[model samples]
Target: MVFVFGVNFPEQRLASLERFYGVGPQLSERLMARFHIHPTAKIGALGGRQITDLNAELTKLTIENDLRRKIQDNIKRLRDMGSYRGRRHAMGLPVRGQKTRTQITTARRLNRVDRKG
Candidate 1:
């Protein structure tokens, strides 16, 4: 009776019939008993040894989330706020108003192009 509804006896597959979903524990056990299917019951506490790779998952989720673009937007917002740091960032100058006479040259460096050969 229960065998007709796919009780799954050993490795033998019965006829190709419509599948009946969600059999209760009692019903499943009963069906297993009737069909002579020995259920391999998993006993004892489960040892969770599977570790997820966060870098790969982060890259996958980060693309859809666009976190990199969000950071750039934040930087633009801070620059637009025109705070002391923002002003420095806007002018590409040191925030502490450090003298760039002979120390730093990157920001105040002049490209003296000598065209005389």
Candidate 2:
């Protein structure tokens, strides 16, 4: 296993690095390039130094629990301020101007004051 912060990634798995909450393909590619790691490399192929370096870089970014907390805090702040977006979140509706007449399942599930991701 290869551990990034508190998360354990299987060594046999590809080192996509998108498992972190706030990380995406672009950021993952940037990180891999910064570490001189190839895109198709496996977690097991990483050297100890590379792993440490990657950890160091990851720590510098707002990811995982920190990012989640930040988003939740922003929602809470909006709610406290009674903003339109806050009201939408509280109502479990779309906050990005999506139509609410139908097909709002995703927004209803995700747009809430206590969001997990």
Candidate 3:
């Protein structure tokens, strides 16, 4: 299963049925009315070709230029916070939390076997 625009698209064979989860029964029927596959068609046996075509169509319908701008702005905001402290501030995490007695087991060690030798 794959999600696009919060709607789940099951694998190709089940693509039409998957629309039922995201769309109302009437809409689902209207959308897939053209496809006259047998109701007994096994979900796994449904052809993936239709699923791929639907995915392409959904991509074309949902993506917009304003969405592109919003994504670009978010990327710029992240990039502007250059340092770890700046990033922590942007993410609302503690910048100066007490580390006393905290586990250092996972801390990266600068000194390795070669350096020790």
Name the Cα RMSD for model 3: 12.7
Q: How do all models score by TM-score?
A: 0.30, 0.94, 0.30
lDDT by residue for model 1 (1-117), tens: 222312432223431211233334665465445434445522111112201221232234433226445544554676678666555555656546787566656543421121011
Model 2: worst 10 consecutive residues (lDDT sum): 1-10
lDDT of each: 0.39, 0.93, 0.45
Please provide, for model 3 over 6-90, each residue's C-alpha lDDT reduced to its tens digit, 9 standing for 90 to 100: 5654545444544423345554454445454454454455456644554564454423444445554554455476755445444
Candidate 2 local lDDT, 70-114, one digit each (tens): 999999999999999999999999998999999999998899999
Worst-scoring 10-residue span by lDDT in model 1: 43-52
Which 10-residue span in candidate 3 carries the lowest summed lDDT?
108-117
In model 2, pairs of residues that clash are: none
Greater-lDDT candidate between 1 and 3: 3
